[model samples]
Target: MIRIGKSVIVLVLLLLAARPHVYAQATDVVALTPTDDLLTALRIESSLSVFIDSLHHRTVRDIQVMPFSPVGRAVPNAGYTSEQARANPIWLRFRVQNATNKPIPLFVRVNFWCFESLQLFVTQTPEKTSAQTGSEALIRLLPPRVSRAVSTTAVDSLPGLLAASPVVGWRTPVAARPVHNRHFFFPVTVPAGADYTVYLRTLKVRGAQVVPVSLLRQAAYETWMQRDYLFWGGVLMTLLFVSLMSFFFFITTRDPIYWTYLLCVICLIGFMVINNGFLNQFAPSVQFWLPRQNCYFLFPLLLFYSNLVFVRTFLPLKKTPLRWLHRLSAGVLLAGLFCVLMLVVENWVQLSSPVEMAFLRLFTLFYWLPMPVMAAYVVMSLYRRYYRSAAWLYLVAITPFYILNFGQVVANFGLIPTYRPLVNFDIYAATGLFEVLALTFGLAYRYKLMRDNSDRLLSSQREQERTTFATEVQTLAQKNSLLEERERIARDLHDNVGAQLAFMITSLLHIGRQVEQQPIVNGKIQAEQLRTIVGYARDAIRTLRETIWAIQQERFTLAEFEERLNQYVNRYVQQTNGLDVVVEVEGDSGQPLTSAQVLNLFRIVQEALSNVVQHARATEATVRLQTQPNGTFCLTIQDNGQGLNFSPDDADNGERHYGISNMKRRTEELGASFRIYANAGTVVEARREAEMAN
Candidate 1:
C-alpha cells in the first residue's frame, strides 16, 4: 500500500510537469473572435480614393464612398411650396475603400451635406437653371488626380423641395469640433442650382490601420475579455488540480506538507486572479473597491506564497536560517495581504490612478523577489547534497517564470511601451506554463528520490542474503564435525568392548571343558566349579548383550532392526533350555523406514524381550511382526507360561524395572505406542506408526 501511494503521487507530479511543454508545443493562441465592422465600413467607401496607414505603416488604396441615405424621388407640393423650399432634405453617403495594393476590401461612412444646418437632402432631382436655360445642375466627378473633374447634369433642386414636404433645420453649427485629437466627422453641402463636385485622391496609409477606430476598440475589448477568461480559467484549474493533489497526497501519505501546499496554491491562485482583473468580470461590483494599482504587489505576493510552499516541500529547510527564510517569505506575503486589505478598505481611492497602482505593484514585486532567490538557494543547497539533477530541474522550472514575471513587473511599472501585449506574451499566460513546468520538476525530483531509495533497499536485501548464506554454511560445517565425532566414538566402543567380551567368552568355554574332563575329588568342589563357570558365562553373555544392543541402537537401519530382533529371540532359546522362542515376520520386505524410526522400534523390541526374559520366566515365547490395515507395523511378544503376579502399579511406580519404561519411552519417541500386560503370561506390544502420505 505504501508503494502504491508513492507511485500515484509520482505519476501525478510527472503528468503536471510534462503538461506545459506539451501544451506549448501544440499552439499558443487561446481564442479568436472575428468582426465585420471594418469590412462594412470599407464597402461603403468604394467610390472614394483614400489611403490608410496601419500601425505597421503599410499603405492601402482605392477607397470608395457610398451614400448613407439614398436620394428620395421628387414629390408634389403637400404644403406651402415656397415655405418647403426654405427647408432642405438630408441625405448621407458611405464610401468603400480598397487600401491594400492587392485590392483589400473596406467599408467607410461619409456624411453628406453634414455642415449645412438646413434640412438634410432626402432626394436627388434634375432641374434647369434660369441662367443656362436648358442646362441642369452638373454632377461633378474627379479622376485619380486631386484636381481633375467631370460634370453630369444630375441634380439642381432644393433638397427640401425634392422631397414632398419641407424639413426642419437646426440653427446649430454645421460641423462638430474634433475631440481628443480625433477628427470624428465628415461634412459636405450642395447648394441649389450648383454643380456638386466630388474629388477623390489616394493618400499614403497603412492598410491594416484601415480598420475603423470603433472596430479597434471592439477588438481590444474582446481581447481583454478573452484574457480574462483564460487567466481565471487557468487559475481555477490550477487551484482545482492543486487541491486534488493535496487531498490525494494527504490521504495516501498522511503528509502535512501537501495540505499546506494546497492551501498556499489556493491563496496564490486567488491572489493572481484578483490581481489580473479576471475576478472583475465575475464580481464587477468589487471592481470599484479593488485597487488595480496594487496588482503589481498582489502578483509578487502570490508568487512568494506559491514558491515558498514549493521550496519548503522540495527542500524541507526546517532548521536554522533557511527555515527563517520561509518565515520571512510568509511575512512578506502577509504584508502584501495587509496592503490588499488597506486598498480594499480605502475603496481604491487611496491608489487614485494607474500611476499609484503601478507604484504599489512595483513595491509588491520587491516583496516577491525573495521567493525566487530563496528557491535558488534551495536548489543550490540540494546540489551540494548530491541532488544535482533535482537542483537542475528546479532551476529550469523556475527560470521561465522568473523571467516572464519579471517582465510583467517591469511592464507594471510602465517601463514597457505596451502593457497588454507584453502581459499576454510574457506574464499572464506564461506564468501558467511556468507553473506546470515547476510541478513537473517537482515530480522528477520525487522520482529520483524513489529510485535512490529503491536502489538502497535492493543493496540492503542483497547484503542480508549474503549474511544468511554465510550463517547457513557455518551451521552445516558444525553439524559435519559433530557427525564425525559420533562415528569415531561408535567405532571405538565396538572395537574395545566387543573384542574383550569375545575373549572372555572363549576362555570360559575352555575352562568349562577342562573342568568337565578333570576328575573331581569331592562333589561339593565339582559343584562349586560348575557354579563358577555358569556365573562366568552369564556375566559374559550380559556384557555381550549390552554391547550389541548399544552398538545396534546407535546406527540401526531397517535390515539391522529385523536381524537384531531374530538374534535376541535365538539367544533367549539358547539361554532358557526348556523354553522355545519362535519369531515370525510379515509385510513387504522391500519397504523401508527412516533410521530414527527403525532405531526407536528396535530398542522398543529389545526392551520388551528383555522384560520377558527376566520377568516372564515362561515356558514358551512367540514374537510376531505384522503390518496392520491402518498402514502401521505392529510387533507383539507373548509368552505362554505362568502369568506374572505384578500389578499395574508396579509399572507406574518404577518398581517393575527399567526395561518396560525404556520400551515405552522409545516407542513414544518414534511417535508410536507401547502396550504391556500379563495375560496368561507377559505380553509386550510395540507398534510403529506409518508415515503420512504427502
Candidate 2:
C-alpha cells in the first residue's frame, strides 16, 4: 500500500511537471468504472468539483468555456468577496466517462436544503479526442456543440386538490422545484465509452453559500435515499411523540412550568419540521409557505423566553436580593418580543437581497444572549446554596444543552477555519433530544417535591386539629364541674344556714313572749333559750366562712388536702367540748386532684367529723390520709364512741341519717368507694383510683 501510494504521487508529480494545466483539470474528472469489477463503492469528495466564478448570470453556452481553479475548494468561501459575487449563482463543473458497454445513469446530489435553484447541462466531448491527455485534450473539452439539460424539478404539477396551497412560508413551489425532498438531485445518462462534462448552477437567496455536490450510480442513489428516508421518518415520529407528551402534561398538570416547557418543545419541533423539509413533502398540497428564514430566528427566541419562564417558575427568587433577576429575565423576554417584531417585518417586506437584511436581523436576534447568561448565573447561585433545593434539577438538565450549542455556535460563526471537506452533522437532533429528556426528568423531580410538601402540610394541619379537640374537651369538662359546684353551694346555703337562722329567730321570739308575760322576767327557761339562739347564730357564721373558703380554692394536692383536713378537725374539736380529735397524714404526696374532687372529699371529711362530735358521744377521733404509688389514694375516719349501725340505702332514720347520706353521696360522686363499719368504733374509709389525664 505504501509503495502504491508512493508510485501514484510520483506519477501525479511527473504528470503535473509534464502538463500542469491538463493534469490539474483532469484530477476533477470522475471515471465511470464497470460496476461489477469494482471491489468497493467509491467515495467522491463533493469539494473536488471545479468552481467557476459566474457572477454575471452566464448561460450554459457561456459557462462551458469558462476557466476554474483547484484552490476554489469549499464554495462558501469560493470568492464571495463582493456583493456582485454574492448575488450570482454558484457553478460547479464535473467531467464523467462511461467505461461500461451499456449507457449508465449517474446522479449529482446537492446535500443541503433551501437553495432556490439548480440547473444541470450535459455536453458530449468529441469521440476522436476522447483518449487524448494533455493541453490539446483540455482545449478540445470546450465549446460543446451538442448538449442535453436537466432541470431541478423532480416531479410534475397536478391540478386542483393536488396543487400546493397559497400560503406565506411554503417551500419552493412544486412547479419550480418538482423534487419534493429537501436535497437537490439531478440524474443524467452517459453513453457507453462516451465522455461528457456537466455544469450545475445553484442559486441561494440567503444564509450560508456552501454548495456541496455528490456523484452516485443508480443503485447507490436508491440505497442512500432509502436509508435517508428511514432515518428522517423515525426522527419525525419521535419528535411528534415528545411534542404530544409535553402538551398532555401541560393540560393535565396545569402547571406554568410545564406550559413554558411545552412552548419551548413546540418551537424546536417546528424548527425541525421546517428545516428538514417535511413541511415541503407532507402537508395539504405538500406546502410550507411560512416565513422559513424568520422562523429559524423566531423559534430560538421563543425557546429562550420559555426557558427563562421555566426557570423563574421553579426558583425561589422573589424574596431574595437576587429578585432583580426576575426583572432581568423580563428584559430578555421583551428583547425576544422585539426580535419577533423584527422577523414579522422581514416577512412582510420580502426584500430582493434577504441576506443583506438578515445581517441586521441576526445582530438584533442575539440580544437574547442575556437569556443564557441568566441561566448560567442562576446555576452558579444555586450551586453556592449547596444544592439544597429542587432548583438544582434545572442546572443538571440543561448543562449539556448549552455545552453542545456553544460548540455549534462557535463553528457556525467560523471561529475555526474549515480545513477539509465539510460533512453535514445534525447538531439540532442531538442537543434538542438531550435537553427535552433532561428537562422532563427535572420537571418530574419537581413534581415529587411538590407532593412531599403537600403531604407534610396536611399532616401538620391534622396534628393541630387534634390539639384543638383535646383543649375543647377539657374546657367543657371544667364548665360542667363549675355548674355542678354552683348547684352544691346553693343546696348548702339553703339547707344548713337558712334552717339554723330560722330556728334562732323562733327561739328569740319565744323568749321575748315569755319576758312580756312575766313583766320583770328572770326565768331559767328564758335565759337558756336566749343562749341557744346565740349558739345557732355562731354556728351559721362558721358554716358560711367554711363554704367561702372551699369555693375560693381552685385545685389541691394530697399534701394540701391533709393540711385542710387537719385545720377543720382542730376547729371542730375546739367547738365541741370534751371531744379529742387527731389528724394524721401518711406519705405527703404531691398528687394533683381537680377542684371538684377536693371539694367533695373535704366535705365528706367535714360530715364525718360532725357525726363524731354530735352523735358519737366519744372523747377521741382520728382522720388518716394515705396515697399509693399507682396514682390512687385512701382516707379513713374512725372514733372511740358508742357506734350506731345503719345503712344509707335503709329507710330515712330522721335528721341523723341525713348527715350519713350526704357523706356517702359526696364520696360516690367523686368516683371513690365509701364504707362505714358499725362496730365498737365507727370507721369510714374512702378509696379513689387514678383518673385518666387529658
Candidate 3:
C-alpha cells in the first residue's frame, strides 16, 4: 500500500510538472477594450502549455527566438488550476488583440512570488493557424538553448575599488529608495488592427508555478499599484499596532502568552507580505538572499508552533482529566519535524539532483498530516467542553483556513480539481486574524480564572486562621477562670484554718508558761509536755502556710519550693539549739513543679526533719536536694546519731516505724522510690523522675 501510494504521488507530480491536461475549457474571449486611461483586462488563457525552458541566463532577444507552444489564446477571467502547475520553468502561450482603432500600450502584471524569472514575447502572427489544430502542436515545443554571454569579470580594479572601505569623497551620490510594489510588469505597444499573440514565461526552484495575469494600460496600472500599496500598508500597520500592544502587555504582565502571541502576529504579517510578493519590493535583499524553501516554510512553521504553544498555555492539559492532549502535543511536534524534513529534502534535491519520488512522498506527508491532527484536537476540545467559549471561537476562526487549505491539499493529491478561490484569495490570513483576536481574549479569560482561584484560596486560608484564633481565645478564657478558682481556694484555706492554727499555737505557749510558774514536780513535767506540744503546733502552722503559698501560685517552680524547704528546715533547727542542720542543693532546681508534686515533696521533707530532731538524738542533720541532668529529682535526709532499731517489716507501733511508713506512703504518692537505712546514722532517700512529677 505504501509503495502504491508513493507511485501515485510521483505520477501526480509528473502530471503537474508536465503541463495542464489538455482539455477543452469553454472560456469566453473578451477583447481588451481601450479607454483614455489604461484599460483593465483579465484576458488570460484558461489552459496553458508548459515547456521546461533552461535558457535562464539568456537575454530577451535570445529568448524571443526560443520555441514556445502556439496554442494559447487569452480568455477573460481565466486561470490555470493551481494543481496543474509545478515549481519549474514554464512558458505560457496566450493571445491579446488590440481591439481599438488607435495604437495602445498594453501592460501585463503577474501577481505571485513563485516566479523567479519572467519575460514577455509578442508577435502579430502566431506559429499555428487554427485554435483546434494548435493543440496538436504541443509536442517538441523547445530544444535546449545554449548561448555564451559576454563576461565583464576581467575588468581591472581601481585603487579605491580594492580598498576595504570607500574613501570620504570617493563614493557615488546614489539615493537609496526602497521599492514598494508587487507583480512583475511587462510592456508591449501593439498597432491598431492587429492581433498580437503573447507568451508569458517564468522559472522557479520551489512552490507552485501559479501565474495570475492581468492586462492594463499605464494610467490604470498606476492606479492599481497605488490602491494595492495603500491597502497592504494599512493592514501591515494594524498588525504592527497589535504586535506593539501585545509586547506592551507582555512587558507589563510578564506573561509568556503575550510574547508568543506578538511573535505569531508578526509572523502572520510577514507570511502575508512575503507570499503576496510584497517582500520583493519592500525587502529586495531578503528576497534575493534568503532561500526559497526557508521563506516558504518560515511563516507556516512559526504559525503552527506559536499557535500550538499558545493554546497549550491557555488550556493546560495537565490540569484536565482528558488524555488526548498529550497526543495533540505529540502530533504538533511530529508535524513540525515532518515539515522541516520535507523542506530539507526539497532543498537537497534542488542543490544536488532530483529525487522526485522521495520529495513528493515526504512533501505530501508533511502537508496532509497536520490537518487531521489539528482537526481532531479542535473537535475533542469542543466535545470535552475544554475552554468552551474559546474553543468555539477558535473553531469559528479556523473554519475558513481548514475549508480552503483542505481543498488545496486534496487538489495536490489529485483527488479533486484545484479550487480557483484558494489560489486567488488568502483565506488563511482572514481566519488567522480572528484566531489571534480570539486567543487574546482567551488569554485574558485564563488570567481571570487563575486570579479567581488564588483569591478563593486566600479567603479560605484567612477563614481557617480566624477559626483557629477564636478557638485559642476560648481556651485562654477557660484557663484564666481555673487560675482564679485555684487562687480563691488558697485564700480560703489561709484565712480560716491558718487563723485557727495560729490561735492554738498561741494558747499552748501560754499554758506552757503558766505550768512552769506552778513549781511543783509534776507541774514542771506538765509544762515541759506543754512546751513540746507548742513546738508541734508551731511546725504545723508553718507547714500549713507553705501549703497555702504553693496553692496560690499558678506554677510552683522547683527553685521556689527548695527555698521554702530551706526556710522550714532552718526554722526547725532554730527551735532546738543543741542540733545543727545543713541544707545542700545541687544541680538545676528551676524545673517547674505541679501542685501535687509540691505538697507531697514538702510533707516528706518535714517528716524527715521532725524525725531527726525528735527521735534521732543527733547533734547535726543534713538535708540534700539534688536534680540530675537526666531530669531526676532526689531528696536525701541524713542524721549523725544513734540509728533507730526498727526492722523494715515493723509497721505496727514504734514512732520510728510510723515515721518510716508515713514517709514511704508520701513517696509512693509522689511516684518516687523510697528507702531508709542506717549509714553512720540514719539516711532517708526518695527518688522520682521529674517529668512523672507533673
Q: Clashes in each model (backbone N, CA, C under 3 Å)?
A: 56, 9, 0
Cα error, candidate 1, residue 227 (Å): 11
lDDT of 2 at 621: 82
Best lDDT goes to which candidate? 2
Residue-by-residue lDDT tens digits, candidate 2, 1-694: 3343346345434433432122243334577777542322334443255554445456554555666544223333332222223545667766677777989876666664555555565555434234422322111111121222222231111110001111111244433443345665566777798787666666554444556566666667656777777766666677677768767766766778777777777877766666555555555242323353445445556666667766676574656677676677777777767667665665576545556455454544464475465565556565557333454455555554554444334333544322222234244565567667767766766667766877898898898898899889888988887889898887777667888999998888887777777775456777777788888898899787777877887867778777877776667564556568787877746877666677777777777878888888878888887776565667788889988676656514677578777777777776777778766788888888777210
lDDT of each: 0.44, 0.60, 0.58
Per-residue alpha-carbon lDDT of model 1 for 254-297, expressed as tens digits?
55655665665566666655544344324434433444333323
- Residue 691, candidate 3: Cα error in Å is 50
Per-residue alpha-carbon lDDT of model 3 for 1-694, expressed as tens digits?
A: 3343346345545534543333354433335565434545554555343344554444323444566442244211222212212334556555556678887776666666554455455544444323422221111122222112112231112110100111110011111111123555666666676665565655544444455566667657767767667766766777787888788777866878778778778877877877776665556556534344356555666566655665565445646676567566766667777666655554445533345444544555554555555555666776787766655655555555555566555544444445455555444555556566656666666667766877898899999899889989978976875675465445434543555576676777777676667755656666676666666576556656766776676577767877887777666565554578778878766677766567667767777777887888888888888877565778988999888554545644575466577677667766788887789898888888766656
- Which is the leading candidate under TM-score? 2
**lDDT over C-alpha atoms for residue 557 of model 3:** 72
- Best-to-worst TM-score order: 2, 3, 1
Instruction: Predict model 3's lDDT versus the native.
Output: 0.58
Deviating ranges (above 4 Å) for candidate 1: 1-235, 288-300, 319-365, 410-421, 425-427, 430-434, 437-606, 612-670, 675-685, 691-694
Q: What lDDT, from 0 to 1, does candidate 1 have?
A: 0.44
